[model samples]
Target: MRSFVRAGYNLRKKTGKWELKVRPDKDSMLGRGLLSEKEYHDPVRVFRKAFKEYRPEQFLEFLAEAVHFSLGPFNHAPEGNLIGPYLHLVKMIDAAWLIVERASAEK
Candidate 1:
């Protein structure tokens, strides 16, 4: 959850608190008011949707954010998305874990 928020893939927050940082754009379903509040803020749900849709780029974007943090000078804005090492560090598990149910259902 921390990693996802820090990555700002589709959400962000401060002080480890779950808050909405929605930036509705015409390109997103959220902009069309298609996603419920739970769907928009739940990291697992969001990641699952992206993964199931074969959008690996979404993961890359998350990875790029981590890379940007580690290598300060490495700008990811020009690059394209996370599915491996980084996600493991954050979750301490394999990338495949992302597609499965979270350990605890409650956030």
Candidate 2:
């Protein structure tokens, strides 16, 4: 219910089903919808709130290593099968390269 990709939790569709492992984020719309308007408008505050649930270390690792897929695999990926993470990496790269560039700028 936290939209497509809520950042803190990864939403996956395996056999036509959606799974949310962590909590429903009580402040989000899909959750309890109890956040103040100021919190809703502040990007930094929002990111901090989201990061509280997700691991920022993993995020940093993603930024550092995913940019180099041609280099090697990420040995520190979350414990699970590799396909999901790889697919997510491809999706993130594609979005940044294909969508953001066209939608926002010529670069």
Candidate 3:
């Protein structure tokens, strides 16, 4: 069994709505205890290890393009269905950027 820590953040929508997100960090206290001291001490290394699970750089570029296209003034989205996907993309890119920043900071 895995343990996790729940975290929430406010995401503002273009329609003036606030989205509440609950993110799982760990499965439980046991999971926390199971992690090594080095894993806990250097978050950037941990992030890099985890980020390897995804195509971070590619995803970052993809999300940035999606956001640009979706939010562009010339785009025709009168109904605003694109907003949700745009926000999600932004969040993913932000996370990737953070990881990159941390990795650079470690140097």
Candidate 4:
């Protein structure tokens, strides 16, 4: 049987705490009340939903992919909605990195 996994990443903060960060697409959906906050807030739920397990390196890969796809094809529109999602993605990346670094030190 083929098993599909929804891969996600977590970053460790200086305070010795692990913070899980989800993709902006997933985060926005959860923030907008479209997806259950439980999914984002609960690690177990996130792991189960993502289907595939992920490590720090994999999480970094995901962030890089999102950044690569976002910083291109300049928009001439007046509103910044086009790039707003990318901005949020950047923040998520930072958070994930922080979590990873913190967790590594703890181990």
Best by lDDT: 1
Better of 3 and 4 by lDDT: 4
TM-score for predicted model 3 compared with the true structure: 0.28
Q: How far is 94's C-alpha from truth in model 3 (Å)?
A: 1.4
lDDT by residue (42-70, candidate 2, tens digit) is 32333344445444455545444545554
Model 2 CA RMSD to the hidden true structure, in angstroms? 14.8
Tens-place lDDT per residue, model 4, 1-107, is 01111123221212213534445443465243322454334323433333233344444455555555578864453332324333334444444444455458668
Q: Where's the lowest-lDDT run of ten residues in candidate 1? A: 11-20
Q: Given candidate 2, what's the lDDT at residue 5?
A: 36
Which numbered prediction scores highest in TM-score against the true structure?
A: 4
Sorting all predicted structures by lDDT, with the top scorer first, yields 1, 4, 2, 3
lDDT of 1 by residue, 13-106 (tens): 2122322355435335533233345544443444444444433454556656765677766544533324443443343222223223333323
TM-score of each candidate structure, all chains considered together: 0.25, 0.27, 0.28, 0.31
Name the regions of candidate 1 deviating beyond 4 angstroms. 1-35, 38-47, 54-61, 68-70, 74-77, 81-107
Evaluate model 2: give its lDDT: 0.37
Off by over 4 Å in 3: 1-80
The local distance difference test score of each candidate is 0.40, 0.37, 0.37, 0.39
Tens-digit lDDT string for candidate 3 (32-61): 343344433333333344334433443345
Better of 1 and 4 by lDDT: 1
Candidate 2 runs further than 4 Å off? 1-40, 70-107
lDDT of 1: 0.40
